[model samples]
Target: MKMIVGKGSCGIAAGANKVSDSAEQYIKDNNLDIDVSVTGCIGMCYLEPIVDFIRDDGTKTTYVLVNAENIKEIIDSELKGETLTKYEMPEVDKQRLEKQTRIALRNCGVINPEHIEEYIAKGGYKAIEKCVTEMTPEEVIEEIKVSGLAGRGGAGFPTWFKWNAARSAQGTKKYTICNADEGDPGAFMDRAVLEGDPHAVLEGMLIGAYAMGSDEGVIYVRAEYPLAIVRLNIAIKQAEEKGFLGDNIFGSNFSFRIRIKAGAGAFVCGEETALIASLEGERGMPRLKPPFPANKGYWQKPSNINNVETYANVAWIILNGGKAFSAMGTPNSKGTKVFALTGKIKKGGLVEIPMGATVKDVIFDIGGGIKEDRAFKAVQMGGPSGGCIPADLVDTLIDYKTLAATGAIMGSGGMVVMDETTCMVDMARFFLDFTCKESCGKCIHCRLGTKRMLEILTRITDGEGKDGDIELLESLALNIKSSALCGLGQTAPNPVLTTIRYFRNEYEDHIYKKKCTAHQCKNLVSYTIDADKCKGCTLCARNCPVGAISGTVKNPHVIDTDKCIKCGKCLSSCNFGAVIVD
Candidate 1:
């Protein structure tokens, strides 16, 4: 009998390590004959620490939400060929699985990341072998061009065009870079791929090197992703030992070597120019690009850079051919995208869906809808730089063009769901706050413009907005979008602009009525005690940290507005629901 447990990031976060340890201890104590192993994320991150048991009869049973306590039960039941009725089986939908074309994440949770042979067993380096032996540099580039694979790192630049530019450049020593500096908040898709399947990325880079006529490659990963960096380092060493990375790799003249360069967790390093600067041991700032990276990049030589997920897809493209890879997604966007679905979502985790899948399908069917059955308000795609899409557009297909049309770019695939409790005005203000702090201050328009927009949004949320504040915000957003130096500044206004487009009523109510409809604006909310519901209890008065509630035993309570701190402690303390915030 064999048993496998998920040990991916989400799984670990859900206590998969504790479960595995306990299961092993239980097996030892019971003297059970079972093979226990660790795998990666199975994608259903909501029910993580998933355990799979293979019986002697060759039947496989998967158990979801397995924790440390459940290990004893699993050992007592599955290990002894007894079924546990407590754990329900997850239903598999072929449509959901078929919608995703897992080229980039093919081997993510399927193999042990630390073992080189497991990667080899899964046909890992076969693409590089074929590229080195059978295909010429021009043929490889042509194949990628025909495949219609675009960059997955925010901008949908054609991958083949980048390769051809670098290949045709007049440079003896070209460089290839994998931009693993995934700094987007609430985004862990790239980190999952790098940690769970490092070899796939390495293979993709090798193929990319062969296609672009590059000799050296660097993986610019952030230092914060310690697990991913460790796995990548192990994979690099394994590849070198197997003659896949060094000179005459796999018994061919093509030679490529890769090195890991740790980023200092700068969000701007995800940009190509900033990445190149950091790789060159300089400040991680975007430089002016007349001579793009393809023309004169990295130490002033032709270089090509792609995200971790993009590189992970290359080996699959080479193996499966262009048509097979192209058939899965929309005509223009020919691949499945991995997204870190989070925030207010019931089933928040890593989800891989086709390019044309509707946002509603993802949020409802896949994500199992919002947590606590809250009314869906909006979904924030992309990151802080992205926009909030209204619920009416939930049926919109999640393609690059469609998302772009809604003032949101298909950024590094970070989808955060929001519910009715969320105030759009406050949401916009929160994102502005993030962008204002993250602004590099490289350009005058972005530096001054973001600060001004944030100020206006703050004023609106605080019920201090004047008549023309909205107009001022719109004007500042336009100026920042138009005059900013890079993508960071250009897209920083997306949250403010999109919120105004979809939830203007909320903004108007705040400005005109001086009210926060969602009760999210702390300054606009007033704490009060209901005399009838008070029941003469001094609980509210006793629990009030600032002594705002005034009452005696067996007497009705009253709130002192001047002394109230608006912390809502009285609301929780009153058993009869006497205290309320309006």
Candidate 2:
């Protein structure tokens, strides 16, 4: 029998390492023959620190939220051939896993990532071997073209087209790069893949290198993902020792070598040219289009770059045949896409679903809807650069064309669900603030225009907005979208434009009525005591941080708005429902 503990970043954060150590110590002390190992996250992060016990017959039982305290009891129960129902995975989480199709993340939580043999047992590097031995580079490219796999990074461009471009381009020193610099605020699809199954990405990159006639590969990952980098370094070394990488791979003429380049966490470097520029030891910034990366990339040679998720799909498409992958999703978007489901969500973690599933399907069925059973208001897709889709559009299909039609791009698949309590105006301001700060300051339109828009948004949220502030913001957004040199500036105005398009009423309330309907903007929120409900128990008065509440015991209390500071302490501290926010 074997016991596997989750050790991904999320699992580690939840104290899975302590659980693993305790279980190992127990096995050592008891002289048990059970083997203990670790695996990456299983996408059901809500029930993290998950422990799995595999019997000799291959039957596996999963236990959620396992800690050092109860791990011994669970192991003891398993040894006695008895099931502990309390520690077992919940039925709702099981349903969450059953509803979706997982392709890119197939082996993520199933195998031990640090072990090369485990990855190989699951057919790890076979796709690259097949590519080098049986088929030519053209055949491999044709297979990918048939699969209809687009770039999962954000652009949704055809992957085969980029490979073909680099293959046919005039350059002996070509390159195949993996864009692991995932910088979207709520996005971690790439990071999870890199941490959980680094081999899948490496094998995919190896296949890409073979098809593009490139012997050199580089994974440009952000420095923030230290765990992923460490695991990747381990995978690279293992692959080299096993001949899956390096010269004369599979005993063929095609040879490839891969190295890692740690990025400085610049959001703009997600763009290809900017990433290449950063790799060239220059300031991370985007360049003009005539000499696109396909023709002139990374040291001015012909190069092909695809993000981590895009590369993760390569081996699958190669093995299962492209037609199988194209069988899923809408006509435009093929196969499944991974999304980081976060914000006011009950099951906040990695979610991979087929392309055509509705937002309702993901949020309601898989995500278990909004937290605290609050009214779902909006979901921000594509991070700071992507726009918001209001509650009315919850049924919108998840696809390239469908989401784009809703003013939101399927940008790296970040679904930030918002509830009714979230102020749309302030939410827009928050995203605009992120983009404004992340701007590389290359273009006057992005640098200055976003600054101006942010100022107007700040004024609106602070209750100093005027009637024409919305119009001014719209005009500036259009200008920046048209004039900005890169995707960063062009899409920076998305959150603002989308908020105005869907929730213009919220903007008007903040600007014209001088009120924040959701009571989220502190400058506009006011606290008052309900005269009838106030028991004057002194709890509110004593808990008030600034001595804002006043009254004797057993009498009606009053809130001094001047001293309240809008902290809402009295509201929470009051046992009775006396405090009201307006």
Candidate 3:
């Protein structure tokens, strides 16, 4: 029998390493014959530090939240032929994985990423071998075209079109790049795949390089993902040792090579041109269109770029045939998409679901609804480039055209759920703040227009808003969207525009009534003590950092409103819930 522990970044953060070490020590001391191994995250990060037990009979059982303290008990229980229900993964979490289709993340949690043998055993590198030995470059591109696969980075442009463009472009040399510089706030889908299944991404890129007739490649990943970078480097070396990379693979004339370029975490580098600039050792910024990347990219050579998720689906599509993938989702958006489900959510982690699935299906059905049983308010789809989707539109289908109709893009798949406690006005301001700081200042409209909008939002949230502020914001957003140079600048106003479109009332309340409905803006909220509920235990007074509350023991406390910093310390410290926000 063998045990496999999850060592993904999430699992490591939750102390999986300690559990692995402890289990190894226990086995050494007891002279048990059990073998231990490691795998990547399984997407159930909420119950992390997971351990899977594989019996000799080939049956597998998973245990969640395993740690050093309980590893012995679990091992002992398993050895005695007894079941420990508490340690087992809950059925609800299992159902979360069951209700979805996993394509890009197929081998993520199942295989040992460091071992090429494991990946080869699971049909890795076969697609590229097929391309090199039997299929022609045109045949490979045709299969992708039939699959209806688009760029999964943000823009849903046809994958076949880009590959075809690079193949047909007039250039002596060409390049293939994977945009792994995922800078979205709540997105980690790329990171998880890189750490869990690096070979899958490499294999997909190999197929793309063959199809596009590019002999050189680069993966522009952010330096923040050290684990992903390390694993990717390891996978690349292993592939090279196995003759999958470098000159003339499978004894064919198709020679290709790939290298890693670590980015400085600039959000604009997510754009293809900006990424190319960074890869060339220049400042990360976007260039003009017309001479798009396919024509003159990376030292004026033809180049094709796709994000990690896009490349991950390539091998799958080639192996299974494109029609098999095209049959899954809506007409416009085919196959499945990977999402980094986060923010005010109960089962927050990675989620992979088919296209056309409703927002409610992901949040309520798969995500297990809002945290603390709070009322769902809105969800921020995509990232700063995307827009907010209100709860009223929970049933909206998650397709490129449909989400675009609701003022949101299917950007890089970041689903940030918001509860009733989240203020829509403030949320818009938050995204605007991120976009404003990330702007490359190449476009005057995006640089100054986003700044002007952010200032107005700040004033409104701080209770200093004036008349016509909403109109001024709308005008600036529209102007910036039209005049910006690159996609980063063009979509910078998404959050502000989307909030104004869906939740105008919240903005009006902040501007006209001088009130924040969600009680999130501290300037518009005041803390007060409830006499009937206050036990006067001095917990609130002692916990208040500013010493704003005053009272003797056993007496009702009084809050000095002028001195209170609006930090909500009293409400959290009080046992009887005496503090209230007004």
Candidate 4:
């Protein structure tokens, strides 16, 4: 029997390491003929610490939420050839797995990410071998073009177009870069890929380097992703040992090598120009395009840049043939896209779907709807740079053109689900605040305009907004979008713009009525004592940090509205349902 524990970052955080330790110790002590190993995340994060037991007959049993103690029990059951239904993976999770079209995540939860043998057994380096051995660079480029795979890193630029440009560029030297610097606020698709399936990403880069006739590759991953960095280092060393990364790989004249460049966690570096600038040891800021990376990138040599997800799709496309992938999504956008599900979501984790799938299917069917079964209000797609898609557009087909039409770009697939209690105005404010701080200050319009817009949003949320603030925000957003030097500043106001477009009433309520309908903005809400429900055990008064509640002992306490900070301490402390927020 073989026991594999999901030991990606999420799995480790959920105690997969402990489970693995216990399972290994148990197997050793009992002298069982079982091998224990680890794999990366499967995107089923909610059922983390997932343990997969493969019997000698090749049947597999998946156990969810396994810990040190329960894992021993599960191992004992496996030894006895008995099934433990209690720890079995739920049907809903199985359905979720069956629902995803998984291309990038194909080997994530299945293979040992650190083992080359396991990866090769699953057809790991075949794509690069096919590229270097079977097909010419031009043939490889044509195959990618036929597959119609665009850059999965938000811009949706043709992957083949970039490679061809780099391939055709008249330069003595060329380079290939994987933009693993995934800095989106709630996105982790890249991190998961890097951690769970490092070799796949490396293989993709190898093929890209070969296609572009480059001898060097670099993975510009975020330093915050220590696990990914560690794993990438390990994978590179492993590939080098196997003669896959060094000079003349697979007996072909093509020679390529990859090194890691850990980024300083700048969100702006997600942009290609900015990433290149950072790679050159400069400020992570964007420069004017037209040199366009392919023409002159990375020390002014021809370069091809694709994000982690984009490169991840390469091996699959090459092996399966481009037409096989192009057969999937819409005309403009082809193949499956991976998204990070977060914020007020029940089944919050990684989500992968074909281009034509609707938002409804992901958020409701796959995501298991909102947390606590709350009313789904809006989904903040694309992170701070993306927009807040309202519930009305839940059925919107999740294609590049379609999502763009909704005022949100499918930015590297960050789908933050929001519930009814989420204040749209505050949500916009929150995203704006992130952009304002993250602004590299390269462009005057973005630096000052976003700050100005943020100030107005702050005023609106604080119940201090005046007339024309809305108009002022819209005007600033337009100017910033038109004049900002980079994609970061250009799309900084997207959340604000989308909220104003779809939930203008919420803005008006905060500005005109001095009320937040969702009651999220503390400055616009106050706590009051409900006389009918107050038992007055002095708990409210004792808990009020600012002495906001005052009354005789055993009498119905009243809240001093002027003194209240809207902290809701009294509300939580009161045994009786006395404190009310309004």
State residue 192's C-alpha deviation in candidate 1, in Å: 0.9
Query: Which lDDT values do the candidates have, in the order given?
Result: 0.86, 0.93, 0.93, 0.91
Q: Candidate 2's residue-wise lDDT over 496-515, tens digit each?
A: 99999999999999988888
lDDT winner between candidates 1 and 2 = 2
Q: In model 4, where is the ten-residue run with the lowest total lDDT?
A: 571-580
lDDT of 3 by residue, 20-84 (tens): 99999999999987899989878888999999988777878899999998998988888766668
Give lDDT tens digits, candidate 1, residues 1-582: 988887887888889989999989988987989998777675667778788888989988778888889778876887668878567455643244445557677777678888889999999899999999999999999888878889988998999999999999998899999999998887888988988899999999999999998999999998988888888999999999999999998787789999999998778778899889889898877878879999899999999999998888888889889777777677778778888889999878778877888889888887879999989999998898899888999988888898889887788899999998888999898888887887777889888888989999999998898998888899899999999878888888999999999998889999998889888998888988778887986877878899887778888889999998788888777789877788
Distance (Å) between predicted and true CA of 276, model 2?
A: 0.7
- Give candidate 1 regions above 4 Å deviation: 92-101, 553-556, 573-575
Find the number of clashing residue pairs for candidate 3.
Answer: 0
Better of 3 and 4 by TM-score: 3
lDDT, candidate 4, 329-406, per-residue tens: 998989999989988989989988999999999999999999999899999888988898899989999899999999
Model 4, runs deviating above 4 Å = 28-33, 552-554
Number of colliding residue pairs in each model: 0, 0, 0, 0
State the local distance difference test value for candidate 3. Answer: 0.93
Predicted structure with the largest TM-score when compared to the true one: 2
Q: List the residue pairs that clash in candidate 2.
A: none
RMSD of each: 2.0, 0.9, 1.1, 1.4
Query: Model 2, residue 383: displacement in angstroms?
Result: 0.7
How close to the true structure is residue 240 of candidate 2, measured as C-alpha lDDT? 95
